[model samples]
Target: MTDFDTGIGDLAERLVTATRTGDHDYVADVLAKLAADDPRTRASALLRDLVDTGAGMIRARTREDNDALYTFDVTTEHDEPVHVDIVPPAPRAALRALAASLNRDAVDRDIHAVLATRGTPDEVVTVLVQCLLWTLELRDTRTPAVRLNCF
Candidate 1:
């Protein structure tokens, strides 16, 4: 695999472990590294900007067919409002699989409501990693929309 791919895989693993174990510092460190390594992508840039701001909000909405839409809103240093939406492929299925792999409880609850209610750090990071992985997959596919920053 390419170095970028390897880096992402490693970071994803680390983020999962950290999130599961409630290691917020480790999660933050991993996110910083990811942002530094891939500053151009929306996910990475958003990570960097959010870290810089030290405050942001995430909203989740469930779509049809077990899909999900995650919206991240943050204000930049210039007071510019930025909103990013990350819709992972079959998010409910993906999150269920993730929970299984992590040996966590079944995701029977409404994930959107959980997130909107300021869910646990674990929930937040889990969704963030999913979105990051989706973005990386999109990058690998060289999708025209991703290439054109149309996502």
Candidate 2:
């Protein structure tokens, strides 16, 4: 796999380990890494959109259902009140669904779903989403006590 492809796997593994150890900082660290101006921004933006429209599609287990609302402060010095929302799925759902997409009967269908929502026909993104889903799945393990509905 390419570095970018491999990076997703690495990120997944890190998220897994982080969850196992109850390290809340790992998500922040992953999100904060400035890989590309657009990619990172898009990642955060997609996260916001997910929480807002597709909440429970990739969310933290620690948060309550009402806490699914996420506000991304994208305000810049040149901008004002630039805010965004992120509705994430429970980590478990994201994991199962994402993994399922890889080998499940709904491969093309799942991919189309993402494309409709994420506007990407790129396989790279498909793989990346899998990684992201796996990462969050591991993250959910950190808080086994906080259970919620899984997709």
The TM-score leader among the candidates is: 2
Off by over 4 Å in 2: 1-6, 32-96, 99-151
Worst 10 residues of 1 by lDDT: 53-62
List the global CA lDDT of all models.
0.37, 0.38
Candidate 2, residue 149: lDDT: 28
* TM-scores of the models, in the order given: 0.27, 0.32
- Tens digits of per-residue lDDT for model 2, 1-151: 5323454435445544565577757544444442233434434333322322222333433344542333223343554543322223323233333333323325543443343233232332433344445345544555534222222
Candidate No. with top lDDT = 2
RMSD of each: 16.7, 12.4
The local lDDT score (0 to 100) that residue 68 gets in candidate 1 is 41
Cα displacement (Å) at residue 95, model 2: 7.5
Model 1 superposed RMSD (Cα): 16.7
